[model samples]
Target: MRILRFRAFTRPGDPTSGNPAGVVLDAESLSDADMLGIAADLGFSETAFLSAIEPDAARVRYFTPRAEIAFCGHATIASGVALAREGAGSTVAFTTNAGVVPVAVSPERATLTAVETSVEPLGGVLLAELLDALRLETTDLDPMLPPAFIRGGNPHPLVPVAAGVLGRLDHDADAVLRLQDRKGWDGTIPVVHRISADRFASRNPFPRGGIREDPATGSAAAGLGAYLRQHGLVTMPAEVTVEQGAETGRPSSILVSIPPEGRIRVTGSAETL
Candidate 1:
């Protein structure tokens, strides 16, 4: 089966810094094992396979190098761009494992609307474990933002830390993986600093998905939006910008829109890599 490659959530006009994902447009004949093998072979953080496609919608699946994920934001964005390139349409609904994700694409950018979202308080034990794994003390946390678990398409613990602390975090990979498995979390998203009410810098250690750090995490961003709104941190109907991947040298910009009704919208630019 032929596979297409694209970089999603990239810096405008610079494909070198975005998260690389595989896109398989003609995936109808492939089985679950086949898709997993393809994703593993591609060795990207995640790959998107579209087994069914139509003018207005498509059935899609997402896989990481290690396992199948419920949904992937960057891969979904890449799929939207790929569909547009293949003449699918300007807008399309992707029937995904999480739910129906709607995406809109222009020539230069793509935006995806996440499914229903929510935030839950993290238990003290798990929060302590996570903080210890990252060598962070409770005092290191951002007083205003605190820590909580956010769920957009997947679950992640969003820990808010003081400025300059995010770039300094280093955790044992195996321990992080064990914690993720124990808690069933996709990743631990450490939001390093809040630049402003509308801007923030975040980092994620994704040992469970077999990555040390993700350049741009749309899933986490969506969840972060929900977390912010849930805590009454941001005003209603807000547009927030996230800066990621700078530590990895492939900086990414993710635009998140939180509506008054609570659904989060994530938008980014993509390019073929």
Candidate 2:
């Protein structure tokens, strides 16, 4: 398998490394073990493998170093760009572990419409557990947004922070991993730092999937959009763009749209290696 690596939100990583994305177009030949091993070696937040099932659709899978995620935004963006580069520019459906998500591509960017998932308000035990794991108190959280566990294709905890704290992303990777492994949390303990009345910058601690932080997470953005709309934090006919991974130096952007009916639209731009 030929794996192409591209620097997302930045070109060239230092010795510390940027978010390295692996683009595998002809991924049908790779076994699950093969994909997992490749992802482990690459050590990116997520590696996307697109297996062509027909002329228009592909079975897309995302692998982290430790496990296979149901969905991934950065990988999807990278894969969509790869497909466009291969001259498959039409709308394509990706059958993910979460569900079938449709991706639309243009030369400029790609937008993904996530298959909807219901929202279960999280303010009791699950919410407390997540807060304790992240070493944060409820006082530090935005009371207006409250605490919510939103599902866009997967699950995520939405904790809104005060404005301008998004760049302060610091965590013990092992501690995060310990919590995820022990507690079986799917989405990261998402830190909604730098959140205004509407726009926000967020970070995801996805140790559950063997990833420490995700630069630009489309899935989480989708979930966040849903959470915002469901709780009336951000009103309808509004779109908020999220900035992530600036601290780790692989800055990424996620544009999320909230419709009047509370559906989400997530968009991002990608490049080829």
Candidate 3:
């Protein structure tokens, strides 16, 4: 089994943007447990294992250190790029825990159209608990955008905060675990700015998955697009870009599209290392 690690959303070695993803080849031979172990060994926020069901279609699954997630955007971009190198075309689709995600690969970039996404109302008790785990105050949120539960393939509590705080995300790992299990949530991020009136700035804390921070998160960004739409944060219909990882030195970005109807589209580019 071969594993490929790459930078996504933003350039590698550039602080303050992008996602670092692990790509696995010949994953058809590996079992689910084997895949999970591989993710643990790689130590990336997400690792993708490809099991081909068709030449143009494959069953793709994502694994974090802690468990299998429904989908992962960065890994999808990395995989699409790898496949294209092997003669895979620009248009492609991957079956994931989230659903069938369509991907478009360009000469120097790959964009993944996320499965259906939506925003759920936040449960006050659970939100408070997560905030407590991170030692955040309600005032930290951007008064402009209220918090909501954003669901792409995974669920994330969208905490709209100030851009300055995006670089100051800190939290208790144990408490995050407790909150994740207690609230049945997968991950959480405190957001501040929308890159454009449509885009956003965010920092994700994924202690539940054993990740202190996620440099670039496409799935979460996709979810955010839906959450923003639901809350009327962006009354105008538009595609948005998300910038992350700057505070930690691995700058990343995610481009998302939201239509009045249908699933949100998340796009990003990845490079092999």
The local lDDT score (0 to 100) that residue 249 gets in candidate 2 is: 64
**Across residues 1-273, which tens digit of lDDT does each residue of candidate 3 receive?**
678887778664554345777888778889878998999998888888887745477788888888888888788888888777767766878988788898887645787888888777664887788678877778776666777778777888877775566566677778877877777776555455654686677778777676777778887888887887777767656778787777767877778888787778777777765
Higher-scoring candidate on TM-score, 1 or 2: 1
* Full candidate order by TM-score, most accurate first: 1, 3, 2
- Candidate 2 displacement at residue 250 in angstroms: 1.6
The regions of model 3 sitting more than 4 angstroms off are: 12-17, 53-55, 188-190
Residue 58 local lDDT, model 1: 93
What lDDT is reached at residue 172 by model 3? 78
Worst 10 residues of 1 by lDDT: 184-193
Q: Which ten residues in a row have the lowest lDDT in candidate 3?
A: 10-19
- Model 3 clash tally, residue pairs: 12
Model 1: CA > 4 A from native:
none
User: lDDT for model 3, on a 0 to 1 scale?
Assistant: 0.76
Superposition error at 200 for model 3 (Å)? 1.8
Tens digits of lDDT, candidate 1, 27-53 = 999988989899989988889999778
Root-mean-square deviation of each candidate, in angstroms? 1.3, 3.1, 2.2
Error of 1 at 3 (Å): 0.8
**What C-alpha lDDT, on a 0 to 100 scale, does residue 26 get in candidate 2?**
77
